[model samples]
Target chain A: MSSTTQIPFVDYLILDDPPYLQAQECKSCGARYFDRRNACANCFANNFQPVAVQSEGVVTSFSIIQMGPNPYVSAIVDCGGTNVKCTIMKVEPTPDHVTLGMRVKLMTYSMGEDNEGTEAVAFGFEPI
Target chain B: MGTDAIWIIGSNMTKFGKHPDKDVVDLAAEASRDALQDADISLSEVGVLGVGNLMNASAGIGQQLQKQIGQTGIPVFNVSNACATGATALRVAIMAVKAGETDVGMAVGVEKLAGAGLLGQRGPKPEAETWQPNGRFGALSSTEGRIGTSIMPGVFAQVGMEYGHKYGGASFELFAKISEKNHAHSTLNPLAAYQKRFTLEEIMNDVMIAYPNTRPMCSGNCDGAAAMIVVSDEKMKSMPSEVQSRAVKVSASVLTSDPYEDGCQILPDVNTLTKNAASQAYEQAGVGPEDLDLVELHDCFATAELVHYDNLMLCEEGGAVDFFQSGAPWRDGTKPVNVSGGLQSKGHPIAATGIANIHEIVMHLRGEAGDRQIEGARVGLAHVIGLGSACGIHILEKVA
Candidate 1:
């Protein structure tokens, strides 16, 4: 029931230079959807174009995780399109201070470093 | 309206978790036989069969169980509802007797986690490639960032952190205390997963799983089964006095599903469902929480039990820590809880947890809960909550 905005493949690749966050958008309903799909999640409109969105939103809800496979800041972001919930990277002092409606900007980082030291970059949010 | 009253005649359960020698069918049949033998009844006397199994992993559980139990003609219905499968089955059996559908019905909840081995034993998986904005696939699976982790501990840890932040204190001490208490109680329960006692300091300093949550605070995965037999008063009258003496009446059995609201915490939803269920149960049993002698709540994590205290109205919100510190909810407490160690110590085999809770309450009411029995328990309550926020609450009273 909530609206979502998608980040186009071209925009994501140009921004962080990765294909993981590529998304598609519908011009009719203005709903953005993540993951590569030919059809839009809303309005079922096939008419769409590539666009770069500022990877920033406010933290709506967050949890200070303790016992997980890999500890990270998990939260929901109201990115003016669809309030997306995503894990943030390189944030410190726990997710408690990342209060509701607090500004957060996305960053490219890896959860854990690889052997080659050229970390696998993924999209994460941080306090603005 | 039914003329006869439904009474629980007997209950039995096997130790939970990873028994290679026993498969799911074996566990169900074994527990069924044990329950029947405990009641001194034969398989032919079972007019109907109800089975609760969440994940039997490609095995045709219902058909297989009927074959294993040697019950050929009677109706055997298989029920599944994430973690509340066992409780759901029990409800069906109770209703059948209450509605005059059958004179005798058996409810059995079984799981064979051991057969799955390690890789197959992982927690619930994601639906597909649809990635959630939270970097996770769905509600069940972990984020791509964190694989091989469980959602139970992770979700509860989030609750713990929120509670800590709002209350201006850390939850480590409370979590440790809860673990310590359940562990102490488990020492007296022979069937519990972990019988070793743990100190608060030990629980606090143990290996961390998520923040503020230690390994001991989380429940371990295991395999096992539990079963109970219910019969109408007319059928029960023909049984031996010893069997009749153990009869426990079903006061209430209620189930509820998830609410439509998003961002709603899991524990609060459980509280709402519990209150609704308990109110109905108390009215039917002619008693209230104040009159309860003992209870067995779903304690998959230490924090879960603590949250239950407030949710079950044992204490006020933010009052569980104080109530727990006062040594209440213990075997000697006014209203003892988790005397069988709960899921924290007893092991969580998903579907089996509900019937398992009922099994403990029946034992307590029968004055057969060796060592951990609440002295002269007249009324007891059991609450089992599952994934997707499904919950079942059963209230039992000893038949005079």
Candidate 2:
């Protein structure tokens, strides 16, 4: 395993001065995605350009999953460009606590540490 | 879609739910055997066998299941499209018969959803990834995937919430009502997993799974198998009068994939896919939703059933609540959605679900739905959705 203490969980995630998410934009259309696609879902474009997306967005939808490997607040956050599925880091998974149309920003933190103490980091959005 | 007569001569299904005594192969072979028996045909008569399955953790299931019934070297094709696997398999069978590729074909679907085994595994090797959000869709190395712990339930609960957000007066109560009705509908289905009814209060009070979704509101993870025998119309003419009178026509079988676009939305996401498939199916059948007498839709969640009400054109936009309250989706309701208790009550065995939906409709088309039977039901539609994703819509009409 790499000994990097600050590792972005997914390849598209870039840990910069102020962390942000990167997505692939279809050359044929303005549509963007978190990962590389062989072909665009829109216009069937094969060429794409990587662009930085502001983690800041509004919650379009949310669901509190109670039965799973972990019980958490799952939200579909629309960042003006695309929708991302992730958990709300700082909120409970309840309708009363998490409201629709709430503003949120992308946040990243160490998820867990390995035996070597190297931390595995993850990204999520939190209510602004 | 062809002039050639294709009819559903046989249908068979195992009582859905957790089956401790049955393995995946056992379930497949048993259902296939019963289907062949029901059709009054020998295994040698079936030229091709199409199998639908989701997880292949227990690899080579098609061949493995064939071994249980003594494989005769007839080719077995396996199609996996998450939950739509079964429907896709049946579609392939229908297409083959329509093309005269085979006079008789067998379509079978089987799955072991929960228990000591993982979703697809037949052993006790705790494959915890099955319980993870997005299954294989989520990138484990991605920070986005790690934070998204909510999978299907959370995704659908958002659908319910979004429907309420868009159309006032829709909430958990409406979702629970759908669940309550399906559970009640299951009470009349002998093959339904949960053949019992729950009140709205009881449904709402059930264990909270996703915020708006409870255990009862969501489909149960269980093991089961279902099968259908699709025969060419030419072959149909040779069958006995009794069998000929019970034939059901396959008017349309349409399937589609997700059309991803900018501004990705959730509750609205499925509606787009469903609408496309439903329209294509209606066109292929040369009929509109207005002609549909009963529907066996993918009720993977309560919201799906509710949202699909509008998507399939069963009701006007934001008209689900009023349409539902008017008894449109009840057992005796004009629409009669999920007369087999739907996946919410029948237990979703992934691949088996589509075939199960087909079995339910065939029963209704043949006037054999018994207690849940709709008088003079003629046209019916069966639907299934898989998350990678694929949507399948098939229209079945009774033919004498």
Candidate 3:
């Protein structure tokens, strides 16, 4: 195995083996958020707990973005009752391929490496 | 019959488009001077001033304007509330007049955004290749570019798509057709940034900034300013008969923000706040949707126009598609909307939009809007919603 150490691009993304995402669940309202929150956006409760998010999800909404340097699919995936915004990967960015109700699973890919060979990994959802 | 009622005696707006030679203050002073002229009053007689600007909110634009338009040493309020800045400024003047603090007040909104392209990514700038830790979001970048998009066009596009997904009837073609209507309406607006008409095919075939929103469908960012002069009912009766006859009554002025709800927090909830504001405005005005003769809403995007049709209660719930298909929003239709070609073609100069909308309505109420005038328009509504989640609604009525 290569000696490059992997770093998750975001705090909520776990870079361990069989990597998955985590959410901050509000104890009062059960509202889940990817980033750390001081208060629940729904209930305004300060209490929270970290919970593992389901790896698999279904696409609820998507848009084939053509404005950027390259065309890509930007989507909202419903993963085990939690809505997660993500980019769909490992598939063509077209209406026929990436569509609503499509099933997808969490995956990580390297964004780039720093001077000391620390790889910054970003997360996306791919067709399961 | 209420003596506390506020009236708008004069309103004016500069032609919305590029003004390379003039700065923000220059544009603001011109609008302010013209509004005072329309009111047949002098700046020396103005009691208070409220200036709205988003791009340069901190520069004391109100004071700068006073320097050019004869400083009255009145209480100057520099206001900023995103796209609703103009209306907020107008509200300031109205409140002052109603509170008896000032018999006459003026509000001005100005912006210089010509040639400023697509809403760029906001927040920490990512390096050319490698990722770096940033403020607030930490190592995570702004959610704008990554997951879906936070850009105005992209967010509004997704909002429209989600609406379509929930309710049938919204199609790519339907959205394009909505754009065609606005572009066609622009042809009659001499001061609109772009007064060109486009066919549905041309709009759909043009470059797509975001799905369902083409270049022609999105609001053009440009330079412009709008100003208004307000006075109390007591003050209005003292004015000349011609000025009193031309004045428009402020039926309602309401502003609202998003209420907490269960949904994707990433996408903005443009519906609830708008509905709340509209409900409160109608109640205050003692008028319902059918009573309005014309409306100038924030059509920042064509998709936005469709959704706002429902938000503003211009149609039955889940009936925007039917309303559009009925050809009711046309200039000649029952409920004429965006008669100034809307933001889609009239141009959206952020701060100027709110008062600019009010200007359109006031002009129609006074029977001064040439060419695109809504016949015998007695009551009109001007609505604008900003994404920091503020929605402002104003109802105006012509004096019979």
Writing each residue's lDDT as its tens digit, candidate 2 over B155-244 gives: 667776666666756677888999999999999888888887899999999888777888898898888999989898888888888778
Per-residue lDDT of model 3, residues A64-102, tens digit only: 677868877777787888878788888887656865678
* TM-score on alpha carbons, each prediction: 0.78, 0.89, 0.94
- Show where candidate 1 strays beyond 4 Å: A1-70, A75-85, A93-123, B1-4, B115-143, B146-150, B165-170, B265-269
Considering just the first chain, candidate 3 attains a TM-score of: 0.93
The candidates, ranked best first by DockQ, are 3, 2, 1
RMSD to native for every prediction? 7.2, 4.3, 2.3
Clashes of each: 15, 7, 0
Docking class of 3: medium
Model 3 regions lying over 4 Å from their true place: B1-3, B123-131, B140-144
Docking class of 1: incorrect
Which predicted model would earn the best TM-score? Answer: 3
Deviation in Å, model 1, residue B228 alpha carbon: 0.4
Candidate 1: tens digits of C-alpha lDDT, residues A1-128: 32232322122323344333433456765555543446653456777755555567765435545544556655655565544546665566353554555788766543333233322234566678
